[model samples]
Target: MSEDGVSAGGGKMRRRDLLTLIGTVAGSAVMYRAMSAMALAGESGFTGPIKLEGDPKGASVLILGAGMAGMCAAYELRKAGYKVQILEYNDRPGGRNWSLYGGDTYTELGGFTQKVEFDKGLYLNPGPWRLPYHHQAILHYCKVLNVALEPFVQVNYAAYVHSTKAFGGKPKRYREVHADFNGYVAELLAKSTQQGRLDQAVTREDQEILLEAMREWGALDKNYEYRKGLLASERRGYVSDPGGGTTSAPIPSDPMAMSDLLKSGLWGSISAGHIYEFQNTIFQPKGGMGMIGKAFGRELEGVIAYDSKVIDIHQDAKGVTATYVNAKTGGPPRKAQADYCICTIPASILGQIPMNVGDAMQSAIQALYYDASIKVGLQFKRRFWEQDESIYGGISFTDQPNGMIGYPATDYFSDGKGVLLGAYTFGPAAFEYAAMSPQERVAKTVEYGANVHPQYRDEFENGVAVAWHRVPWTLGCAAHWTEALRAEHYDNLVAMDGRIMLAGEHASRLPAWQEGALLSSLDAIRRLHQRVMTS
Candidate 1:
């Protein structure tokens, strides 16, 4: 046997093999612990392309909502020989996957209308902007639909993190706060180890290795202390950068004390990007997130009946039928029929619609509540954030009503006009913003954004604000499911109910994401296709 307890000829066992051995010998909990220690967790459940094997045999399906979920269902079902038709409430294809650009006009539920005045190429994605790298289903569709994508900078070291109650109400660079916090934590741990406080937890040999690793990782001095020095400057950056000329000297910036950093609460912003969904390598469609929906709409031309708002849904043993009305004109109701139905409507609106389903399905539909969110997009005559603050792209978080200010991810270094997501708020702030008029919301967003970007008043040209609760079609943002609700009603909501099935972000574990909608649609149709083949 090898020294590490493997066969002599096996060499060093691979990580997967070691994990398998641990799982086999010990329990899954032990294997999980091993994996966590190695930082080899978080695998995507999406397996490649979904295959609907066997002929669908002319089964007709009626899909509601032309969003990602509905469009995905229509595309795949049609390819699998199922006759498909989609009913959409809006005059366009994308539901919440929407963008606003020059000349675009929107009227909220309170009858407040705003016409976007952005430059020709500048636009704002009002919903679902950033796409995680692990969302394979949506990425697959992006590839299929030929949607170009670019990196979305979720975290930039140069960006600012501000708190009104700390640092004299001033903002600090992300790198300084992040590096200092890490360095102080490492220094404390190293001191504890050296004092023999961690003797029981760490071996004498391992303690040496840990101290060495911590010194390097924490950018500490030889004596295992983090203080004012060149080593610390490398991570948090120097106050005066080194230059290659006659006056070429570098001055190290002092590291913040542990008490000051902890009191500032800037560490909270550092972990925003560390969250699984917001990690690096996140992407956005080249033009806007709406590109995906627009591409799907073009591919499924004439298949989607735009502005056909579904009023009621009825299903029997043989087939399903839907009653609809023109969303714009409010004319007499019309009816559409199919062998099966995949309803992708948000539960906030779907609960009010009359649907003939079991008591369990009805209860599940009513049990879900949608979240409220508000986004404000502001257009500027000049790219003041880039030119003045050197903030090209990324978010600046604050403890204000606006919550966060997101710089434009596109059109970097351009001399022309630019747009920025001025405000993005959720929870109570969202509701407060929703209660205001659209104009009031825009004015308030500009007022709050001025705190972060002082150029807001002078550079501001025009703006648009979307209070999700005021949206006519969705009524609110994505569904918010509690742990108890998921345990009691989630399966019943997604399960095929007689001749009908439900598909959307509301039906999947990943809510409010296009990936969740696509995945839910794929799973729903996969089961529906199986039923079709058997019947």
Candidate 2:
């Protein structure tokens, strides 16, 4: 619940009721306990900022891809007095952190909000997912931009059930998914303590031991499985992923394809998708996630370009030459010479642009897949979820990519009630949705939202879909992480040829997150700065 017990919708206060509701959640104990051991490393995630030595002369900075990474980089550089120019392929900023406007409350299409590092490390959606602590950089950016974030209270516990429909559809709720997770986790900790393992240095052997014990304890079932589903190649998230050769698999002939996940194929009943879960606590910007972009854009003042697109990049013995297309004009492309060019475009887009990466790194660049997203934000005139500010009931639908997501009218805003909801699609499903006509996508989003929240059916009766897929600049809502690139391309992703510098949420160790984008941006900028400084 929020500090004031106000629903995320700013509905009536319900602290007393929330306390009672939390008691009924059966499995939270096990989840929290199990995760305690695997929390974020205590080491500071960032070191001191790399200060420029007297800054560069004629350092007209060219920052490509105006998502969180690009925006943050531009803001940082501009503050430092560098002549910065942001060339965005999209018409607007805030790549994946997309949102909608028009009502008292804005509709957030991408980049869900959460409380990072609250009492513990950032809470993750183990299932039917959401989080309290996510979007660390976004929140920080919000503060810097003076955007107000509303603290939302829970109307009811975000619940997940393991009924027959859960396998593909939104798989249950937090209560069901995390059943006994907390207690089991606590039990594991107790046992480890007795064995003198608690608080010990985390050695490679220690990690393996913990992994085995965690599997037995059931942490791997949800956490590992969920992680492996999206990122199968490296098994970075799954306990079984690393120690290969079938920890438990009939194994698949085609490891890369999704067909191998069928019930009869290999790991019967559970695939990479089955292992994932969503946390119940998700927050919304007081207005909308879009306000975040709008706010950041404002903070940038005269820096962010509205119709600027980076078309080509060329490098030579002196420095780099960046060619840009004026998105608003049909005329020829405009070119600019810069001391450095920082690229934050998805690898898919990056691969299309001519850079100097040869045969060795070509395959890696080709494999980076941005989970295609087709967001259809439907604006309606009704309370919908009413006073519940659960942010789409903190819903988690594992079944369809076109699942519905929304928040209450009062939660979104008290007066002139309305629901801004949409669909999140990907892979083949994303392609299908991307092919959909604007009208068709709106119909589907409204239909789907009605199904997910039958209580809000009346709200979407004549709703309209404001789709990102149809927008030429926003090819799709932000980007997503997949198993393919993490395994095959982690090395090549960072393999610097000193040609194109890569940074964005996808390029970082953490995928599809604002913090990851910031870290990657800072990383590339620092590296390039250092290279120039030394050279």
Candidate 3:
């Protein structure tokens, strides 16, 4: 806290510098915990239900943008005896918590309307699809709303890791890349230890144990060698799968050469599942992610004013008032006022709207930037991935600009049509695809996806592409924050200014996540309630 960035313990380290040191010495998992402790990041600080103990004494609240943050605020504030009303631009609830089903229509920024032609019961979640187990607030709401949940497969060995520069452009199974890479790494280490190369670092007894551990962990042969044999085949899979008949003898597939594997760069995709967020036990709603939004909308039956877009936000000595017009039938502007306001609009759109806040807040709003992203949902004629490739419900990574292909996690072994997340691109790739027409985007996904799954050429049915930057509601995917940006303006953006406060992912350390929005709303409501009680 000193001018020279010195800690009280005689250390010369600023907050950001200290965090960087921790991240360098320790891994991301440890640094994330340290960051969470220092309030630099969050790991879903949801410890059971929020306790809004005191009443608001009939104070009214006007909420803007019925996304996760706004809806969460209205639901909780109303329950705590505060009169709550919400103004949502879209007809439905769940801003980014949306799903596109058959007959669902979306009109992007440039007046391009896409009518989804998916089969009945098929859906594509254009926004969030998977919920990490740690996001307890959203999970709690799901449980409260009686929304059924299902498991989401994060890693499937039957899935693929593809690179155009690798293996003559042939896609490799995830298991092959994973097994071969781990096997080769363990073999090298084991040989080094056996030759006493690690004597300076590892003791004799420790080296022996390490060798044993590596042999087991990497499925190495007794000689600690990774080659075309039963050990490697067991890990990577057989050339011909073990069967039940007279021709049941499985053929061991040859392991890729270590140099070839390294050159392929497919090993990079294998470690993605080991990341903290993408780890096991992820879940999704039984129907779609939008089910949560639909549930929220139904619960707040009469409270939300749908299709009402706020044109301007103004606060006075008494309360906050929002000027608005009907989104669909903009005849004339209307006004909605309340004792306090919690605005959950995305910064991308909010910056363009008229809002009278302090210069700090205004500057923060304009300073924040939203990242570009795009997702293409393609409906295929049959369950070819499951039937032909034995890939059930996981993602197949590709080095192509389209990013990855995600198979549907639900309805296994079904005879009906299925949808595939053919392309999920970000950054420059997203902008490139966004430049194209929706149909062109869909076609590009099919073209790129065919390299991984050739069935796309024959089984393609219909498709819909959602470019986040073009989407009218959000304009971009989520808030993109750098360390410097967060330091300068994050507090100004989140702090309650007079009778108005901002609540969304942009207001929390956990940006681009629904949990951040919910947490921001909870924090805002708690502070607002305290202010009301004290006043």
Candidate 4:
């Protein structure tokens, strides 16, 4: 070959390599840019001074809070063609359902296991076994996504959390210790049932049947008022000894009595036959819960405003207009316009937003709750416990502070090389945990595990914390139905006022879960579509 020909070939190769590098760099830039934009938008805390342009042609819509619910609402509305733009105050969507990506791994920090991934521990004793609402939506979405799931007909799983301690010095004398747990459970249920309406939530016909069984078994020397009081004592966080210790104060009768009665009643009726027919038949997806969230976000990406924050929203007679700042724009916030607005921001934060709306909207926003939670996900250097695919356990804290331990992710292919454990917590204690540094939080988590699984303390020390309360957009974890909070308000939580709409996990038909978030968004969209079409 001639020297000139060799040089010519080298030049062509150089050009080709340069083009390839450029393409790769550009692609990475886009992803990084998108992530940064969303993060900044959330930080701007734009419930501040903002402006908007004229409402776009047609009935354009603006939605806020891009968690699962907001994402679902956008997905539905976009298809219906209302020029929708979802404003996610958070850097990313999925609300509480978030995953961390490090190296070649992913872990779920919030949300429950996917319906398809039923056996990954954390498995719901499905059916009547605490369905947690979102599981139903998960099942539904799985079908839509063409994901597969299986049911566990019979699985031996025993690990749970409760607010009670073991009996101490005094209770040891009573012959009560002889009763097996099943017997105790049976006796308690029978006693409560015989007392009448232990579960106020049940109907008259069912109550009679429950009472008859309780009457047949016969109960201990009874104290209708006393037992009810003990239940209330613990219900208020004054956990008592499981060995039959009593509380000092008399328990209030109304809610606590009903609550305790129902629990005893539930356990009494629960059986393997009942489980097969009622609960514990969990379903799992082929992949993890992350797959489901990724699928939903992937499908709805086009409609989501990844880097925009709705700084302020204003609505007049015709429709509502939203003002958003571009996190990507950097210096000054960029601007975007929308018609119908479906905001998924928690009502707690919404109260702080200075958006232009009526007193009702403002009042509802002010009433929202952002329960404190500490979500810790640990990746051990290795799996240190006898982990069965079916059984998951949670540790209970009787007084000061408590923790829930869960096996959130299993290294199916990696042979347990790395495992993900999760827990849910709320109240002032959660706030304190959230205040710790990443390293400090990890240390605390190790202490938490070391208390229960002494063998795995070092393994746990190798873990990390994904403190949601610290995250700007979320600023908290999990929602609860407090005594002061009304269940029905959840339905009207996002009631529409003029042209504005609301949606989020708290505003769902289900208890606060990923399913509720997704379902709430869809619900908002349905209402929005009607408002626009009929308006």
Candidate 5:
């Protein structure tokens, strides 16, 4: 092989081949970040606050569902000189963007009601919690609404990464696993370069710089080895404390063996914070994520009709009509008419509602599928994870059915009680959790969480589990969009059908995010305004 490319099994290895090798080892999350950095992946569609130009000329819009999408439409349209009204099935606003607090009551589709027993000043956001900095649309709303924001820690070194099948079922600190993985990989690369194994891939002058970079980046000693030493202890932590006293010498902990570390699979989770969405500087609304929703609701006070369920929707050549009844009490259906309609109801429930639209739109609605998801909030008598384990915030990942446990980002070190996200499950695990009763789901969360934090067994006071599939208002969580499905139905789904248009997270490329919902609503509102002005 020429000196231009590295020799691999008697064949020249290109840069693309090197990327494939790294992607295979580092997993999809790392690969995605790499691709994104290289401009191979899509960027956030949110370009800033949307401007809805033109006038509706006394036209009115009836919006369905009071979630982020519906609320955004009403807020912007009402400001643009259009008469806007929102019909929300729930008694409260912010459909999926909800927070459960003390004295709140929730009755699922199965008639099982759970009265939240959390202490005052404690809350659990059952939906979107952390807001990525790149989601500028939602952030813009938060700023305009004057909603207070706080930093949401995405990764804590003290948190745990656990797998029941690894490390004899014991949880390992994230920092230790992370440091060991990086150290071992860097050391191996440095050794390979020194042995001329990478001569083709790196020039001799670049190799000298690479070796030095690896040594420092990996926390390696003078020998470029990742092992038990002061350098390694600084990154992975020390077994003993270093103090001012004479007998306070710190003991450097031994690094886990490369083979053992690889088998543990704990390194798989270390890349979570590396993902573009969960990277550092993420924020959460003060109190809870629902604060943003509450602010929106307050701003759109008399415009939203609470507890109004739409039973049927029809449009004629003149206008659109929505027949709705009181959601809580059975009553005669009432009609609400408008020149146009914006439907933001999630596809999971929207598919069941009777609506007259084009065949393409109807087929698109039916084809959209929502995934099942479960979130369990467990209130503990004390913040044991913080007090005992020193885990203030961030998430602890596990291979258990519960998937992961998130520590409270607010009220750090408070002497009072705190709530933890005991379980956040999706896919098959979520379906299994949904099949169980709410109480059973909470119990399962505690049971699975104990594997990570043993204090869960003793400190668990009460818990509330939300299974999106069983929730009456939204039969399932956010829309699950496959590329094939998006290619087939996305355009029809978003296109204005007569006087009716659809807007939600599902309508945009960024599924399952508030930004998607906001952007989708903005796009729909712009198109609807254009049509009205032309007419």
Candidate 6:
């Protein structure tokens, strides 16, 4: 050995050097796993507003679809001095950013039509309802458009989490489940430290600090045990709330046993609000989510051509051409020509449209698959949830087919009728709900909701259901991208082919979100503008 404790072959091996050598020999998969273990994941790519400095010099752009992506493209391109026009299948704009209110009619793909009969001022947002605080693009547009926004209560202590297999099918408050889970987990870690099981992992001085933290965080007794007492009750709740009168006093509730708490599985739903995307300070448009779309429509008064169904897209060195027909009349096809094209149509529908592009783009277009989802809105005669159950707003989770019930964030303590998102299902449950007729879907939603809110049977007045798979315009809810699919096709899907570019949630890193659409549009325009300037 050398004087510095080095082997004959080399100096002493450092940890990072060994990792680098292992990564070089083992490949990217090993490197990725090592980075993940070290918590070195990258931050979001979205930085700020995308500035397209150069002008297009009077070049025109034909945008397909009037969804958030398409509309945002049209709005920005027009501002940038590019003559922009949009073709939309639906008479209205906003695409999936829609809301169904009283007297509204919707027809599905199978020719089944439903008329909403909710009371005035009540509505149901079928898609893209809640807006997270981190979705800066969406919030910026909403602010620019002067749309009024209100807080969306994502988590309520009084909200319920029900598992059919647990607690004899009784729904428990979110706070109780959350408090108990944290308390038990903290107690377990504290106990293990005291038993010297974590001696290797934690230093003796640090162990004392950790024990104190766990005791405070878990609301444990002086002995570091999670047990029935006032300490636990303060975090969970009191059996009888403290009263002001001399005859009444608060009674601490008994804490659930650690074994029973684990078996209940109610702890599973507690972390939903903690997710980065669903965290606190979520917001929604005041009247409905559709208000955002309506505001965009109002701003882009004559730019959108309603009821124009695009049949094909062909691009050449000169320009791009799109053929379309009137959706209402099925009239002869008309051609729209532009120097460049930005197609924001969902991949689910775009795959069917005959388009002339490279083989890579064609393959990418057909590779994406849209997700299936269903949302049902129920009109109630009264706000029984607030008056009787004391649940103001937030979601109540269940293991049943309905999946979850979302209380309305607006209209608190009003004497008028209220609307609630009775059922929201996805994946297999969404397909199951979509298979049923609109009326049947509504009836079943009431039935499943009654299991949680017994007042549903009496208070339910009317309902409307929107199964995204049956939506004629979109065919399905939003693009579903897997790691493998994204790795192979995502870049191809977004890259400009000839004079044509794609912009939508499917084309961006942020899928199924308004921010994704905005970012996708901004990125597409930036590239297209660059191409125009160079040419």
Which has the greatest lDDT? 3
> Candidate 3 on 402-511: residue-level lDDT in tens?
89999999999999999999998798999998888999999999999999999999999999999998998888999989999999999899888999999999999788
Query: RMSD per prediction, one decimal?
Result: 6.2, 16.2, 9.2, 24.4, 5.8, 8.7
lDDT, candidate 1, 322-392, per-residue tens: 99999889999999999999999999999999999998988999998889999999999899888987887
Stretches > 4 Å off in candidate 4: 1-58, 104-135, 147-156, 160-179, 185-279, 283-287, 387-402, 408-414, 420-422, 478-492, 509-511
- Candidate 4 TM-score versus the reference: 0.61
For candidate 2, write residues 319-355 as lDDT tens digits.
6777777765746888766667777877666767777
> Once model 3 is optimally superposed onto the true structure by TM-score, how far is the C-alpha of residue 403 displaced, in angstroms?
0.6
**Local accuracy of candidate 6 as per-residue lDDT tens digits, 1-535:** 2222212122354434544554565597767766763452223434565576777889999999888889888888898899999999999999999999999999998899999998889999999899988787888889989999999999998999998888888888888898899999999999998898988998765565566668878998877888888888888988988888794788989777778879987888888998868987899999999999999999998999999999999988789999999998998999999999999989999999999999898899899888989999999999999989889999999988998999999989989999999988899999999999999999999999998999998999999999999999887888989999999998899998989999999898889998889888888888888888898
Pairs in clash, predicted candidate 5:
none
Model 4: weakest 10-residue lDDT segment is 169-178
| TM-score of each prediction | 0.91, 0.62, 0.91, 0.61, 0.91, 0.91
Decide which is better by TM-score, 2 or 3: 3
lDDT of 2: 0.51
After superposing candidate 1 on the true structure, give the runs of residues whose Cα lies further than 4 Å from its correct spot. 1-45
Clashes of each: 0, 45, 0, 18, 0, 0
* Candidate 6 Cα outliers beyond 4 Å, as residue runs: 1-46
TM-score, cand. 2 vs. native: 0.62
Worst 10 residues of 3 by lDDT: 1-10
lDDT score for residue 325 of model 6: 99
Relative to the true structure, how large is the alpha-carbon lDDT of every model? 0.87, 0.51, 0.89, 0.49, 0.88, 0.87
As a whole number from 0 to 100, the lDDT of residue 355 in candidate 6 is 96
TM-score of 5: 0.91
